[model samples]
Target: MTTTKERALDAAICLAGSQGIRAMTHARVDAAAGLPKGSTSNHFRTRDALLAGVIARIAEGERADLAPAARGPIHSIDEFVDVFTAVVTTLTGPHADRTRARYALFLELSSDPELQAPLRAQRAAFAELARILLAGLGAKHPDAAVEAFMAFGDGLILHRLTVDPGAPVRRSVAIAVRGCLEA
Candidate 1:
């Protein structure tokens, strides 16, 4: 079952994604989450704490979403493509709001030193997972491949979120993964 904290964090993410970071106040989160007044503040004492909660929630959500792919060694490009496609589809589809909120949080992170470490750790973990997959594909330089793949994915996500919502992110990600595997 989703806990009160989880609900509040989700509300913050949704609020930030839909209405920008400025709209993610405690009262707004409470209202968005259908919690009583001050509920969010009770759980998150400060804005930094609330923001941290959102970041943690994003990381946890990503890890859960990617767990299937991480369960075993990826033995083929198709397997990798499937995993990438699933991730892209979620980011551009059902979870698009969360993804947008994450981007907004990411932009805010640049100015919030307190929140940087967790975000960096989350990113490093994701890169490490990409490296593992790239290694399975016989990538000449798995580290470099991971960086390039992450860059491409991030750019594609940003484009989808900002420039063109109708972009074929799943197809584009599949093609990119295939190209990376072939290189």
Candidate 2:
């Protein structure tokens, strides 16, 4: 069973994705979650607290989704592209709302370093993993490869989310993977 906090956070993500940050209030989250009024506030206590909780929830979900790729060995660029293409597919399909919510939060809280800590840490972990994979793939400069791959993935995600939901994800992944290999 989902805890009250989890339900509230899930609802918050949906609200943030659908209505943007300004509309994601404690009462609204409670209503969305089908919890009693004040339930979300009881867990969060403040807007910053709620935002922090939502960020943590998003990071937790993303980390879980990435765990497999991080653990599995990618012996070739094709395998790497396939793994990340699947990740992008999930992000833009079943998890689209949560992915959108994460992007919305990123925009709203871009200037707040404290609020962005979890995201930054998660990003660092991903970059490290990408770096290792790129090195194994014989990238001349793993650090630069990691940066290019990260940027391309982010751009592709944003484009797919806002411009074309049916955009070819594997093609983008292949481009990023090849660029990383060449970097």
Candidate 3:
């Protein structure tokens, strides 16, 4: 069973994803979660707290989804593509709403430098993971490859999220990974 905190956080994510960050107030989260008024506020006392919770939740969900690929070092282009495909499909499919919400929150929180720490940490973690994978893939400069791959993935995700939901993201991911690996 989901805890009240988790429910409220989930509701916040869904609300942000579907209706944008402006719709993610505590009262709205409580109503969306079917919890009593002030329930969300009880868990997260401030808007920053709520935004942080949403960011942390998104990271947790992504870590779980990507766990399978983290079991071992990626050994080949095909293996990497398979993992990339799974990730892209999830991001562009079932998790699209939350992903969109994240982007919305990212933009909304940009003016609040203090609220951006978790997002920066998340990006750093992804970059570290990409560095490891790129090294294993024999990229000439793993650090540069990490930056390029992340930029490609982020751009691809953002484009697919906003403009063309039906874009062949998996194929695009494969191409991008192939280019990174071959460069």
Candidate 4:
């Protein structure tokens, strides 16, 4: 059984995946969740508040799904890569369309302080966690390594959406990962 909030968040995620986040509204959310129109008010009270809740929920889901911070000391770094690989595969594969939609929202969010805060917090927290994981791996410049890894991942994602009409994504990620780890 799912609570209204849980179900609403799920609907929001799928909607954000299918349609751009900007296109999702409380009315649409109620419709998507198969609830009466008052349902959004019952849970979140306002549209902006509801959108924030949905974004927070998505962050929570990513944290759980990634699970990179759940491993032991040294192997945690390896596990991080494994978790990252799985996540990238999912986000870029069957979910690709929705992901592009989400990214579009994220780009818009970059210039909106209200939305930027949480997004920045999410990224900063993830970067910090990644830095900690890399530290245990004996990288002399763990912070730099984490930054490089993140930059590489983002670059590959953008590149995937652009040129190299002949290259594969995982192949691109592989090259970045190997280059970062070996460098």
Per-candidate clash tally:
0, 0, 0, 1
Which 10 successive residues of model 2 have the least lDDT summed? 64-73
- Output the worst ten-in-a-row residue range by lDDT, candidate 1: 174-183
Mind giving the per-residue lDDT tens digits that candidate 2 earns over 1-183?
999999999999999987899879999999999999999999999999999999999899988878768986789888888888988888888888889988888788899999988878887888888889889889998989999999988888888889999999998799878877886
**Which residue ranges in model 1 land beyond 4 Å of their true spot?**
none
lDDT by residue (1-183, candidate 3, tens digit) is: 999999999999999998999999999999999999999999999998899999999989888777767878989878887887788779878998788887887789898878877877877877787789878988887877888899998888888888888888667877888788777
Using TM-score as the measure, which candidate wins? 2
Residue 123, candidate 2: Cα error in Å is 1.4
Tell me the lDDT of candidate 1.
0.85
For each candidate in the order shown, give its overall lDDT on alpha carbons.
0.85, 0.89, 0.86, 0.67
Which prediction has the highest lDDT against the true structure? 2
lDDT of 4: 0.67
lDDT (Cα, 0-100) at 73 in candidate 4: 56
List, residue by residue over 46-165, the lDDT tens digit for candidate 4: 766776786787677666655645454536344555666666666566555445645665776777779657767777887877677666655567778889988976666555544442
Candidate 4 residue runs with Cα over 4 Å from true position: 76-80, 93-102, 157-171
Candidate 3, overall lDDT? Answer: 0.86
Candidate 4: residue pairs that collide: 17-98
Off by over 4 Å in 3: none
